[model samples]
Target: MLFTPTVIKNLLKKPATRLYPFTVREPFPNYRGELYIDIDACIFCGTCARKCPSQCIEVDKEQGLWSCDPHACVYCGICRDTCPTKCLHMKDVHRKPMTERIMMVEKGEPPKPKKKAAEAAPKAEAEPKADDADKGESKKADAKKK
Candidate 1:
């Protein structure tokens, strides 16, 4: 009991606790961090859903959608790799807040029609010259002679 008390007193030289949030640590290069979904690029492929070990990614084709519950994700990065369109990317970002809504594709919304490309301003049409017309006629006469 006497030795334990003496050892404890000496061990408390300085507090080793680090102030988190303020003192951020860099994650490893291979560290699978937060997942970001690019909804527009996603092709409704079920590969992400099938590859997810935790079954966190949900891909409903009939409804044209994919959604993942970050709470259930294990950060394996499988969902990011298996996506064919390269829509899913793993980013080293801050954790999602509880107030953030989960991603889900909306049903019954008609797909927006593709916008017609802007028409390039019409180029000024060249006026046909009398000399050019005469040259064309002579060329045609020469070809007929052959």
Candidate 2:
């Protein structure tokens, strides 16, 4: 309560600074820094975009995707909770630079899970039989006649 000189001096010590761009300080566990949506896992649900209090989330349901303007976010973290797939999260990143205000929109079906070569061993071994190979009885009859 008392504005003592000693207390004031202690508080003024360079004020914690992050070296940003060169070195990023990881945000606290609960710190809502920036929103990131895992488009691959997203089900195209509009819950996140709809629940946004600031209306900063942009989701195109018909196009099956979503994105948000980094500048417009208030870092409220509402979208993260509203996401059904839990695809949305507040990543450990601070406000972006002025030159990077917009987020790139990524759309399309998620990459199919790769089938390991070992799993496909059976298919590779099963080669199609040629027509000549299938006519074994006819070839035997012709050879006996000759």
Candidate 3:
């Protein structure tokens, strides 16, 4: 048969199917797989948590805490879409399987920028105080000329 070469080539090639744990197929560009939060950009506004249909997200603005349940999330991406700061991300990578039911929580504040000592020193003591002396000398010189 003329199909003999095609059959031989297909047989020699690797199988299309792969073991899941060993190899993961790349997710499509639009796949909504998991949630990621950029804590610094987040204003502790509670908007995303309020918009979640499943109520998986919990925010305590007073305590500066954010918590989410991965098991409870449906990956519908409503929270990501509603974020005012666009701090939430619906990534294409799936959440890893977990044996325990644990709340994913992040707390506290974003790190503050450090003030430079060199900049502070220049601000405090850089004035020359020579203008007043220059003005007095100029007045004496003018009186002498008169």
Better of 2 and 3 by TM-score: 3
Predicted model with the maximum lDDT: 3
TM value for model 1: 0.52
Candidate 3 Cα deviation (angstroms), residue 104: 0.7
lDDT of 1 by residue, 16-100 (tens): 6658868767766766778877777766646887678876676654455667778788888888877898988877764657786
For 76-105, candidate 2 gives per-residue lDDT tens digits of 888887788898877665665576456747
**All models: lDDT?**
0.65, 0.67, 0.76
- Rank all candidate structures by their lDDT, best first, as comma-separated numbers: 3, 2, 1
What ranking emerges by TM-score with the best candidate at the front? 3, 2, 1
Q: Which candidate number has the best TM-score? A: 3
Give residue 78's lDDT in candidate 3 (0 to 100): 93
Candidate 2 residues lying further than 4 Å off, grouped into runs, are: 1-26, 110-146
lDDT of 3 by residue, 1-146 (tens): 99999999999999868998889888899999889888878777678776888767877654668889899899999989889889899888888888988888988573332466656643442343244336546966997999
Q: List residue ranges in candidate 1 displaced over 4 A.
A: 1-17, 94-146
TM-score of 2: 0.55
- Which residue runs of candidate 3 sit more than 4 Å off their true CA positions? 1-14, 110-146
